[model samples]
Target: MNNAIKDKVIEILSSIKSGVDFANEDQIVTGGILDSIDITEFITALEEEFDIEIGMEYMENENFDSVDAICEMVEELQEA
Candidate 1:
């Protein structure tokens, strides 16, 4: 995973909801750290930050579950 992307993802996740250790939390979606509205906001933020459109196909719980997962998704999108 890219450290820069991971850092930015953590920053974005923090902006959405503070006080959560995004880096260590592997169950962000399954654990309920972010709700439906927050997920919507997070997707928007991610799209704006990474300059990549997160289509419905990429809107999976596993895609946003952890910092690594988020970084992986962003990197994949960026590469595309």
Candidate 2:
């Protein structure tokens, strides 16, 4: 994973979960890995992390659906 993606994921997780360790890339961030509320917080964090404006279209299951998926979407958006 890209450094920016990893950093952003870590940043987002930090805002949502104080004590949780997000340094491990394999650490899940969805489906029992984190709560729904945390997901919302993660989305917000991503918006700020990448310094890009995200719309509803990017917030769907195809993008902000999971940690890996979200990282991919962020990288794509950054590239674009």
Candidate with the greatest lDDT versus the true structure: 1
Candidate 2 residues lying further than 4 Å off, grouped into runs, are: 18-36
Question: How well does each candidate superpose onto the true structure, as a TM-score?
Answer: 0.96, 0.61
lDDT of 1 by residue, 1-80 (tens): 77888888899899989999888999999999999899999999989988999999998999988888888888999999
Off by over 4 Å in 1: none
Error of 2 at 75 (Å): 1.2
Candidate 2 — worst ten consecutive residues by lDDT sum? Answer: 24-33
Pairs in steric clash, model 2: none
How high is the lDDT of residue 79 in model 1?
Answer: 95
Candidate 1 displacement at residue 58 in angstroms: 0.7
Q: How many backbone clashes does candidate 1 have?
A: 0
Alpha-carbon shift of residue 14 in model 2 (angstroms): 3.5
